[model samples]
Target chain A: MEILLQQIVNGLVQGSVYALVALGYTMVYGILGLINFAHGEVVMIGAMIALTVLQILLAAAFAPVLAVLFSLLAAMAVCMALGYGIERIAYRPLRNAPRLAPLITAIGVSIVLQNLAMMIWGREYHSFPLPFSSTSHQLGGAIVNDVQVAIVVIALLIMSALMWLVHRTRLGRAMRAVAENPAAAALMGVDINRVISATFMLGSALAAIAGFMVSANYGIVHYYMGFMLGLKAFTAAVLGGIGNLRGAMLGGVLLGLIESLGAGYIGDLTGGFLGSNYQDVFAFFVLIAVLILRPSGLLGEKLAERA
Target chain B: MSINKSALLVAFGIALAGCGKSETASNPASAPAGELVIKIGAAAPLTGPQAHIGKDNENGTRMAIDDANARGVTIGGKKAHFELLSEDDQTDPKTATIVAQKLVDAKVNGVIGHLNSGTTIPASAIYFKNGIPQISPSATAVRYTAQGYKTAFRVMSNDAQQGKALGEFAARVLGAKQIAVIDDRTAYGQGLADEFVKSAEANGAKIIVREYTTDKAVDFTAVLTSIKGKQPDLLFFGGMDPQGVPMIKQLRALGVKTQFMMGDGGYTPKLIELAGAAAEGAYASLPGVPLDNMPSGRDFAKRYEERFHQPIQLYAPYCYDAVNVMIAAMQKAGSAEPEKYLPEIGKTEMDGVTAKIAFDEKGDIKGGAVTVYQVGQGKWHAVQTMGGAPAAKP
Candidate 1:
């Protein structure tokens, strides 16, 4: 009972973070039809930048709330510029080449960013400084900390705001147009380049927030922190239907819940033959099952042939 | 087309010249006449999560080489100018083997590290095959020394001794009856935990549950939550501080008030800094007596801090001792060759900053000590010292 409840809470908080990162992959996939593998590095950069800024501000004895806000904005701004630069420098030049070129370039960009980060930050894990001591609140029998609650609430708000921005704004319409057909969108005076770049900036901004949430939740950040997370979030995106916004969100949360619940119950399920250390296996297993059963994902639409 | 061809030719010529320059740089002809440049290879995870400890090992080895050179060591009546060739294994076993082979191929006179037991065990085979003496400063898995590899040696206590001390302390000293154990599933962590469980159970403490996690994992919520349900009186984790810090933090966050403890892998300044408030009252066992109690330990620590501009992390003193012991063997044998000086290491008996350096038949340190430390007011304080000589004022 309480174990189940505790697992659910854990799953939800973790899932929300995955969903935020998944949106970056899904948005880029939707707009450019290219999997921006470097998106994960963008999240890492965001966290690193935010952490550095926060540390400096805190050392200067700034207010905690204001310091957090300033650091987040700084991270978002840097990530936005980075996303734009990556698309311009790496992808734009290969736009007319074979699809594989851009895909490989995305991986190259990711590697470059990772090594660059390692060189700049070194390899030690930096502890995320918390302004307030995390106090746990009990619900029934499970414990929920202030950080976890903030993560869930903030993620929900940002995700909802994203939903509104993508569906109800002029930029959203342009983005949808660009995703539908860049040639057609350009013909319709959509300015395909601007729409694409905007989509990337928007996604990167979300990635920055996701990075902050991850560091805050886990209380530690490292140069290699983004790789596994990006891989998992990408998995969540694919499980939700790679190019679908709602599918990505659903997949992220579902994957998180599945991981937490699977980890929580695996010991009992296997009769102690396996342990929670095999937690990673559950995510991939469910991915394989989902891919085999529903190729288009739970909420993904059937692929449409374009003329 | 001709311009492009000439440009290509020029670039090729420049690349060849660059290679030639490096070749000349490493050429022994550049050394002063009658001076033998003896290369000592050091391998450790110099670029990953364990980089801090790895760098500490490298720095200690470097300091030893510098000191040896300053003293103008002579081997076979030749003035020996010691040179350090450090390689980053990134804490990966595969990389460790590659680094070991690289060191052997470079014809290094001796090897100083390959820090973790997981790395050291695999790399030891490579060193053994090449007949190169390898000394580990911190690899404490009992299997490392028990492998019958004469080339392998360590300066610190093995897991068998450390685990027994930890187990006895948990049951007898702390009086924790119900205990939960978690290991990172690495050779060192798992081996230490297994030994700990054996001794703890033998001491009449009931083992409630055992769990495993990877060294790379940052979150332990699910595992801690599950363990919380068991309501164990104490949770003991056998892993490095990178994982241990988060496990303890997450354990506390889950509102579990169970006592937390870990093996030497958790006994690092980084643990206290990262774990912060969560680290309070946490117990960890570190092999060897406290630095303040060692002969010349305070002086060595002062010199190390002055040189490195940072306080000594765990195992630096041991690393310093391992290098000096290897060099001492070379001096005793009157030759720098591994085969000639290898036997001298077994016969070694010298006072090190950590302890009186000596090796048993298995190449394990003789009479190695283990000390249990508890974090209080954000600093680790030694609560109990087990085995080895009585504390001597530095």
Candidate 2:
């Protein structure tokens, strides 16, 4: 029972980050009808930027909390600008071309960003210097650290804010309008490009937070860290119903739980034939099962003709 | 549509032409007139997680070549201009094989690396088939030399030796009755863990649980949580510092206070730097004595740091020894060609910075040493040295 609780806590912490990154994918997919594959790189860039800022501040003997706050804001601001720039430069040129062009360009942008990060940060894994030490709390035979708790709380708050923005605001209504039909939204006096760009910036800000949470929790960051994370978050978005905001959140948490529990108990479940190393396999297997059983995902609506 | 098709064809044609030009450019003619250019190929993971150690190995090899050139050695009555051709194998077995073939195609007189056992084992075959001698500075898997490949040699001790030392230390010195073992499933990690388990069991320490992960994986919570339930006395990991640092950190975070121990892969300054306080009291074993204790180690490390602007991570000294040993074999045989110096390597009896270098029949270093270390005060302090020849009089 204690092991189960521990795995659940682990899963939740990991899943929260996934959900945060998945929001970026789902939001862009919802508004622009294009999967921003490079969103993961944006997250990596955020962590790298924040790390640099934190290093400088801490070296200058700045207070830990204040340094963290400054770094977080810098990361979010840069990522917002980056999100706006990516849409403007890469997607805008291919907006009128074939759908495949933009999709391929998203992947191209992801690769370009990864190489650029490599050149900037080098390939060595930088140990994230934590300003504050992680203090553990005991909870019914399971242990939870301060950083884990912070990650969960911050992710929830960000996610809740995103939910409120997309549903309860004028910009949210405009975003929904753009998602419904670009031509119709334009006729309705919705600036399609601006709404789309806002969606990306909003999602990217969430990505920056996710990146910070990941580096803080894992205590390590590298240029290639974003690739696997991006892939997993994409899987989460698809599992939750790609364009559905709530579905992305649900999928991310579920995927995280499945991976953690599978990794924890796979040895016994298979009578020791398989080990916890098959943890990644459990995630992809769940994805395949979901795709086969429910093509539209658990909460996804039926396919609608876009053209 | 027709215009797009033509444009694509033209682009494809240009790409093919570009490839052809680069291929020819890479195949430079050997022996540029008078000076005999002795090309030595060095392979390591130059751009990935292990790149730090790989770069160290490359730098060590480059330093040896530069030193040899400055001294201007004569090989077979020709003034040899030593050239170092370094390639990034990216720590992948497939990439290592491709790199091996590329080096062989370039007709390198000798080769010095492929840092990981997973890579060295596969690439060794290519070097053997091409009649090129190869020396690995860090690969410790017993399977490497056990393949009976005359072309394969290593400066460091094999896993069998290091594991024995680690197992004995864990069982006898640490007095851990129950142990849990984990490996990254790489050739080096798995082999080292297997050897440790065997030796530990023989020493009466029961291995309660065995878990495996990949080199690329960062999360080990599930593995740690599972191990936590068992509550072993000590947890031994066999993997590089990249995975090792994170694993130990996560283990500590989960409140699993089992004593942590790892092999040479975890014996680096980066491990301490990355793991922070979590690394305190953690144990690691490395082949050969501590760098400060080796003959001429202090001088070599000082020169290396002066040149590279960084402290030696791990294996740089071994790499330095391997290159010098290979060059010494060439100098002894009076020829840079592999066919001439290949036999001389087996008969080597030179004193390297790391050890009194000599290879047994199997190309394993004669009496190779292994030193166990524990991190305290944010640095590794050597606790004991096992096997190998006794420390020579300074």
Put down candidate 1 lDDT per residue, B1-394, tens digits, no spaces: 9999899989999997785444223333445867888888898887767887888888888888788888888888998888788888888999999989989999999999978999999999999999999999999899998989999999999999999999999999999999999899999999999999999999999988888888888878888888888999999999998899889998888888999999989898888888888999999987788888876888989999999988787888888899999989999999989999999999999989988888999999998788999999999999998876653222
Candidate 2 off by > 4 Å: B1-33, B391-394
What range of 10 consecutive residues in model 1 chain A has the weakest lDDT sum? A298-307
lDDT tens readout by residue for model 1, A1-307 = 8978998999999999999999999999888778999999999999999999999999999999999999999999999999999999999988888889999999999988987898798767788997888889999999999989999899889889989999999999999988888898899898888988898899999999999989988788888888878988988998999889998999999989988888777887787889888877777887788789987777888877533
Compute each candidate's TM-score over C-alphas.
Answer: 0.94, 0.94
lDDT of each: 0.89, 0.89
Model 2, range A1-307, lDDT digits (tens) per residue? Answer: 8999999999999899999999899989887778899999999999999899999999999999999999999999999999999999899888888889999999989988987887888767798988887889999989999999999898888888888988999999999888888899999899988998898899889899999999999898888788878988988998999889999999899889988999999887787789988878877887788789987777888868566
Q: What is the TM-score (0 to 1) of candidate 2?
A: 0.94
Model 2 C-alpha lDDT per residue in residues B1-394, reported as the tens digit of each score: 9999899989999997785455223234434678888888999997777878898888888888878877888888888888877888999999999999999998999999989999999999999999999999999999999998999999999999999989999999999999999999999999999999999999989999988898888888988998999999999999999899899999999988899999999999889988899999999988877878766988999999999988888888888899899988998999988999999999999888887789999999998788899999999998988777873222
Candidate 1 stretches with Cα past 4 Å from truth are A304-307, B1-31, B389-394
Which number leads on DockQ? 2
Q: Lowest summed-lDDT stretch of 10 residues in model 2 chain B?
A: B22-31
DockQ for every model comes to 0.68, 0.69
